[model samples]
Target chain A: MKSVKAFAPATVANVSCGFDILGFAIDAMGDYVEVFRKEEPGLKVISIEDDGGKLPWEVEKNTCAVAIQAMLDDYGQEIGMDIALKKGLPLGSGMGSSAASAVAALVAANRLLGDPYERKDLLPFAIVAEKAACGAGHADNVAPSLLGGFVLIRDYHPLDVIKLHVPDSLYCTLLHPHFQLNTSDSRSVLRDAIPLKHSTIQSGNVAGFVSGLYQEDYELISRSMRDVIAEPYRAVLIPGFYEVREALKAAGALGMGISGSGPTLFALSKGAEKSKEIAKAAEEIYQNIGLGVDVYYSAINTRGAYVLEENK
Target chain B: MKSVKAFAPATVANVSCGFDILGFAIDAMGDYVEVFRKEEPGLKVISIEDDGGKLPWEVEKNTCAVAIQAMLDDYGQEIGMDIALKKGLPLGSGMGSSAASAVAALVAANRLLGDPYERKDLLPFAIVAEKAACGAGHADNVAPSLLGGFVLIRDYHPLDVIKLHVPDSLYCTLLHPHFQLNTSDSRSVLRDAIPLKHSTIQSGNVAGFVSGLYQEDYELISRSMRDVIAEPYRAVLIPGFYEVREALKAAGALGMGISGSGPTLFALSKGAEKSKEIAKAAEEIYQNIGLGVDVYYSAINTRGAYVLEENK
Candidate 1:
């Protein structure tokens, strides 16, 4: 195929208690990328469709460019491609915006290259692209966006990934505050070291949270939802964070926390009715603090990145 | 009922990846305690029938005394009781020796009191007794001993416990080195602070480990079987821990790790035949180092602590 188009769904990483290891895809918004073959033997960014916004146009600085370049190097192929990006998610809103672009581009490029590798085989390339957008090469966001459903990055050295289970009754409500907190600054606010006691508690929560998901126990999930490592320090970056969490809880959210890194807050519930209440409560709290927020309610996204169209 | 007798099983804590949070009961051996009610309003240790070894006869210093005392205080009863103890496991062997005694005593006392509460209602008293032994209150040892099977203590403040699933085919092989390491001394060897990077990696392992148990994925469990927090520091205290671990791995054991702190090393296999081979390999390694060791084999204990006899 000479041209291909793909869509990559947005993913929510960290999942309250699981810090850097857990993530799940959300269906509200995502990014779309198109790749077209060219005679010029290099990757190029044709356009970035946004609302009068400017991003790095240089191929070396863009997420999709770096990821595709890495994949080409590994496959030992030199092919020219022009890429276009359409941002359906707000940049730096903590909804895995960067990861969506990187994943969508890789999926598109793979199709344009005649599908040399399987879908799961493209994670390494996607992760390298994520590193270009953020400083660290974390797969929590990318894996779910690429593979769909709930996913766990068990280890990073060899890039191990495990697809996790999520119940059908579970629903999510995300409130994105109309402000920006980029990935680098969001990560910088966290402490490098933590007490052993805190880590133990965090580990306990991680175990309980994952076990709860498998058992379809909502109460267990609510009780296990906690973050002592980064949430305490990063709470100050988002305005009205504490009050919003309290409101979310008061509205009967099974669990709630910062959705990726900040600017976006998410609460989970066992049903759609409670999910709507959680979103309304959070939005009202943000409005009371003189801030406008965009709310998105969704069931867990089962489909991840996918090829939209291909032409030979 | 004027008298009640109960037996509490031995518990293996930590389970490699989850420190201070995960544990499971073993069927090989346990502690037996009997409580006889009297008209006099005081709790006392009347007899400790062991291998001619004397324990503290005083109530304040003993874990069984502290646990039963707490239970009595909560019940608002000052009934006098004569308590007899029988130790089936060695002390400081990392088999949760002290926890077995405490859990047995609590179960016996509750039975004698006409079953004032359910099985799980006794965790607080059991945990208070564990504090007397470890100097810090933890339920990883006591919960599994009291509730049976695999249990996860998600939080300590409110005492949240979640029972995890264990595959029916999984069996345990433990080699207790002929040495002792006190809980406090084992804890003292560990550092108070950990880098966030290590904790994140550890969290991944914890998530994977629990998920593996529920899915019956032995390969995932083995891959996630790692201890970055306590094992490295405490291994120095055990004489041939590294060589024994290597031997366990060489013998095709699914996973091998410290039983709680040190000295006792446990390996897991899918069935009894492979379990015996794992035990043999570990024992052979310790014998080559000129050290004598005690070995035990068991399937995961489904029944935790139980009333042996209820004399009404």
Candidate 2:
């Protein structure tokens, strides 16, 4: 293929009791990348759109360009390519905006280079791009966005990632308030240590949540979606967090928590219809607080990054 | 049934990353309790055997009598019962010795009282008995000894207990060194708080281990059997712990860790022959250290507490 356009979905990481370990993809919003072959034996960023000119265009600084460079470095080949990124996800929304950009670019570049690597093998490249965008190279977001479905990063030293079973009817409602919460500020609020009592409870919930997914037991899932490590400290950063959580619980959400780091919140339900109801209920809390909120509700995206169009 | 005899299997608790939440029963050794009717409407410990005269005869102090008392109180019936205990497990060997006694007593009393409660419903009474034996009312041991298979005490406040899927070929090898580690001393060594980094890794392993069991992925189970919370600090209490662990790993054991607190170490292997091999490899390490050890290898006990004989 001389040129290819690929799409990658947004994702939610640190899912309730699964902090730093679990993440899942949502189908409602995503980013797209287009790559074209060029005569020059190097990569170039030709254009960018929908990012308010805030995203870096320099190949060394941008997430998409960095991911392509990593892939090229590993392949040990110099291939000419011109890239264009169209960002559909909002910046600093804690919805994995950078992960989507990196994943979309990797998919497009891989397709343009004769598809040398399998889909799952592209994760390390995306993680390097994440490090370029943010300071940490974490895979909770990139794994699900690349592999689709629910993903658990079991170990980090040798990088063992597993795709988990998702319930058929699981739906998500995401509410993003128009405010930027710096990831560094959110990390600062957390303590370096947590009580052993809390850690035991948190691990129990993690085990229970995984079991509930395999058994498809909704009640067990509801009871197990508790966060004791980070939420208690970071909830204050988001306005009306408790009120929004109570409203979502009343609207029949199986569980609700801050998606990624706050300013954005997510609630999970059994079906799309209930997800809509939960969105409406949760929106009122933000509305009463006088904050402009954007809401999206959809089923989980089981197909992570995929080709949109190709020119042969 | 006027007179009934029940047997409850010994258990291995704090299974690696599942400290304070996960446990499983072993079929090779257990405790038996016999309950018979008496004229007076009260509970009494008529005799105790095979305990080296260390167990208490008082109804209030004994685990068997306390569990029967709690059951009778909850049943709101003035039933008279005389209990006889036969112990097969060593005391304070970190093998759920008290849990077996409590479970066996509860099973026998429930049958002698015409079977008012289901097998799972007797967990709380066992917990109360555990509190009477030890200071804490934790269920990691008693729950598995009563309910069978692998058990996760997901939540303690409302007592959410779940029976997890056990891989059919999983085998256990337990090694008890001839030394006692007091539960209080074992607990006192643990800090009230753990580093957030360690807790996150621990929780990741917890989720991965549960998923491994459900998926029947033995390699994943082997990879996720890490315990960063308790093992590092507690290993010093047991002599030759590190050496035994290395030997088991060399013998193709999937994982190894302290069973409950210390002194008793357990290794998990994929099959019976491998478990026997692991047991032999582990026993040699203690022998070189001039310490006596007891070794037992068995399949997981899926049928927990059961009636052995009844006189109607």
Candidate 3:
């Protein structure tokens, strides 16, 4: 059988009201995985580049390696394969770098192994690999990277995910401050219990946001996407979170909130022009503080992970 | 001008996971409102019947009268009209009887006054009337009754609402166990705080449900509609809640949950046969315990509130 190659885009988890259930892929930011059949009997990872010397080479610890290993384990005694990863996004940027690698590797491995597992079935394998990397089972990133478009993880058990339609008018601007905010640390700082009234408001917002997506009503979507529960507590970790959000809102962005954990804030706007303006304004705000920040303007990538090419 | 008559179906609030934000109207159960031009200089409510001798005669306190009063307040004077309300649905049965009366009256008044306010504008008036009735501002019932579909209330202030297209295959069965469950009392029993983990799960379920509606995936909708936070805590007030849910599920009902506060249980089914079976099983379960339950099997009402005949 011919070998294959695939690419999985980096995803933004939470998406405000969606929290662990919602995510979307970025078209221009992600990782690539290449898999080729070999006469050797043992699986091997050939190389991993641009990972800042942070990712481990060991199959169990490496996110992409572990994901490919899981696919091999399920399929049983597949021919040995040389796997290569080209990491495009930064590690620990709250941009789903690990999830992109995991999804890419699993997708490439699945394609190489005569596609033993269905596309949706690869989600758990990707999640397992992510758990090995992040030390937790978080599907927000992996689900979108694996399934593409906007994903809602309804239930983790039996692994149920729903892909939501992204409105064409919606554009995203991601501003990543050049500071690290570990997901583990950010999670530990959150309050164990939230006030009842606040939870009600949050639930209301979540419902509103979901309905907004269905109706394609950007105004209602903007009004409903406000998150009071996690963002309020997590915003303290971001240096210029409030100022950036205010500036984006003033520049005609529909809404703004923390992307994934902290340090990366995202805004949704109606048009490319407004989105670019918001992105430019956000960069200026970060620059005023003398902080380095990377900005990306893109639309939601509806296509998730797929086989990019097949070997002859 | 000749009198105009219209009926707005009563709605079930909460809708399980949504709690105070999600609601849908039920056919065959509602209040009828009639509006007519009168010789008097001020608006007057002629008759309000079927209140079980509990509602006040004062226009300021009655749900329908208060809604009409709101329309008048918005217009700066009475529109010189007479309004009559004939209530059919039982009061405090977790079926949003008061909201139906309020919405119906507002629709009638709006038409009589040449619709000085837009259709969406009447929502705030209905919500205000609801506050007068329940002592709180909630849009679950008002939004659905006013909009005539599955509605997600994005925000109450500056009033944002999104209407979703319900799948054609879905059928609803509602069983009201002749009892009262006040919204205020049910709300007061809840704990002052909730676990963050539970909140996250709730958010995931809501997102999943909305995605399911968009995709028209019944299986996903059923699996995602399960409510862990509110149902477990609130179901204790409803007699045989668990038993009825089990019975409905065993009878091939897609999903079942406590409709609104209590007493009323709702089930979603794929077809009329299953809906009837669910209704029958639920009624038998409650009847065995010496409770009289009224069951209604209907599809989603696409028309929210409308005039039966234009005023001549």
The number of clashing residue pairs in each candidate reads 0, 0, 1
Best-fitting candidate, scored by lDDT: 2
Measured by TM-score, the strongest candidate is 2
Models sorted by TM-score, best on top: 2, 1, 3
Q: Write the per-residue lDDT of candidate 3 for residues A179-295, one digit (tens) a residue.
A: 888888788778889886676677778777767777788887788778877888898888878888888899888899887886688888887888899989988888997899999
Give candidate 2's total backbone clashes: 0
- Which pairs of residues collide in candidate 1? none
Q: What TM-score against the true fold does each predicted structure earn?
A: 0.95, 0.98, 0.95
Ordering by lDDT: 2, 1, 3
lDDT of 2 by residue, B1-312 (tens): 379999999999999999999999998999999999887899889889999999999999999999999998999989999999999999988889999999999999998878899998999999999999988998999999998899999999999999999999999999999988888889999989999999999999989999999998989999999999999989988888888898889999899999999679998889999999988886788789889999999999998989999997
Candidate 1 residue runs with Cα over 4 Å from true position: A37-41, B39-41
Cα lDDT tens digits for candidate 1, B230-258:
99998888898888888988888888899
- Interface RMSD per candidate: 0.6, 0.6, 1.6
Which portions of model 3 show Cα errors greater than 4 Å? A1-3, B309-312
Q: Give a tens-digit lDDT track for model 3, residues B144-168.
A: 8888877777566667677777888
For candidate 1, the docking band is: high
- On DockQ, the stronger of 1 and 2 is 2
